[model samples]
Target: MNNVALITGASRGIGHHLARHFYDLGYTLILIARHAPALEAFAATRDPARITTLAVDLSNTATAEPLLRQVLSDHARIDVLVNAAGIFRPGSTQTPVDDFSTLLATNVTAIHLLCQLCTPWLLKSAQGRIFNLASISGVQPFGSIASYAASKHALVGYSRSIARELGAQGIKVTTLCPDVVNTDMAEGSGLAADEMLSTEDICRAVDFVMSLSPAAIVEQLTIGRQPRPRQPR
Candidate 1:
């Protein structure tokens, strides 16, 4: 692909690994996140020439259009988009109504707005690809992380619907749903990450999505734990 890729939530975790993998394959990178220091560290290794970093909170839904416009205008073109940035706030029976709005805005609204603004630019490039980082919970009624799972489930449906609409335009949309991973988010969950998937594993899936022929698309791929889980003693 001769065009550049824009990656959100690229400061670390799955986002960081994806940036590395894509850069190795010669894809120009545009990394976006809110943390300046982490962004800088990523740039140091990825190089400022091939990979450009943007410190922005994509959760600001109202500014998505203008912000994307500026970035695209400066970069000249965007061939691929990795919607890796996400907010996962687990809610329980006591989940507050006020906080639910914030979770929905960050998890669902941001991705929706970015995809809308990214379409025109993506169509311009021959290798236009949209990768949405969804979760296996999207396919099941995952009750533990209530709001997080709900948002992802909705996102999966939204992404699939958009895929049908955009397929003819030569833009491929892929939703990646991986079971628990060894990321910072999982660290605080009190769940044992033994043999859990790594960020690199998911990034590999992203790379595979890019490598597929336009005639075929991996619309939904469910990745999960290794060896499966054993029953309690």
Candidate 2:
């Protein structure tokens, strides 16, 4: 049987690119997103037998676990679990409490819960891997996105701790921290999409991590965009 990879946020952006990349690598895909139509559309483009689509709002933590259990029940093992679903709200300390809560639920809580739920299937794989898509904001404070930063920071810490705890079980967990990717989230933050990293860049990073030998592991990786050339005077 082909290895199975479950990717959240597979509707677009980095998650979408990663899904395509993994498909090319011959892995069966479980694509999850909040939009059912989009997920189904993407899956339709692929061999239906090799792809599964699940429309889920990970932020709705109340229903996430049961939903995930139902979807995962059919698969005998999950070789890769990519927690790439997240939301970003740009704001300072003045950001509303509700916004902060929403960000936390999607960005941090969902990843944590998914990891817990998928651990058993992961453990069954010979080379199980977990990739949590965090942000450079996890490492440095950005005043405009305080709440988003806080959630990513929490993710980074949690990923590292789990990596250590699960290493003995042969499951590797890696936190991917990238700075200003060319995505809707980064564009919403007022960054120039042309000047930022591409989804391919992030996907390449994931490929590298996943390609490592079973004995080797990258606990955390931070990726940044290349500097743009200065305009001539």
Q: Which stretches of candidate 2 lie over 4 Å from their true place?
A: 229-233
Quote each prediction's TM-score.
Answer: 0.92, 0.96
lDDT values for all models: 0.81, 0.91
TM-score (C-alpha, index-matched) for candidate 2 = 0.96
Model 1, total clashes: 0
Over 4 Å off in model 1, which ranges? 227-233
True lDDT of residue 50, candidate 2: 96
What digit string (tens of lDDT, one per residue) describes model 2 on residues 41-141? 88888899999998989988788789899989989999999999999887879989999999999999999989999999999999999999999999998
What are the per-model C-alpha RMSD values against the true structure? 2.0, 1.3
What is the Cα-based TM-score of model 1? 0.92
The CA-based lDDT of model 2 is what?
Answer: 0.91
Model 1, span 196-217: residue lDDT tens = 7888789778777777766788
Q: Report how far off residue 155 is in candidate 2 (Å).
A: 0.5
Best by TM-score: 2
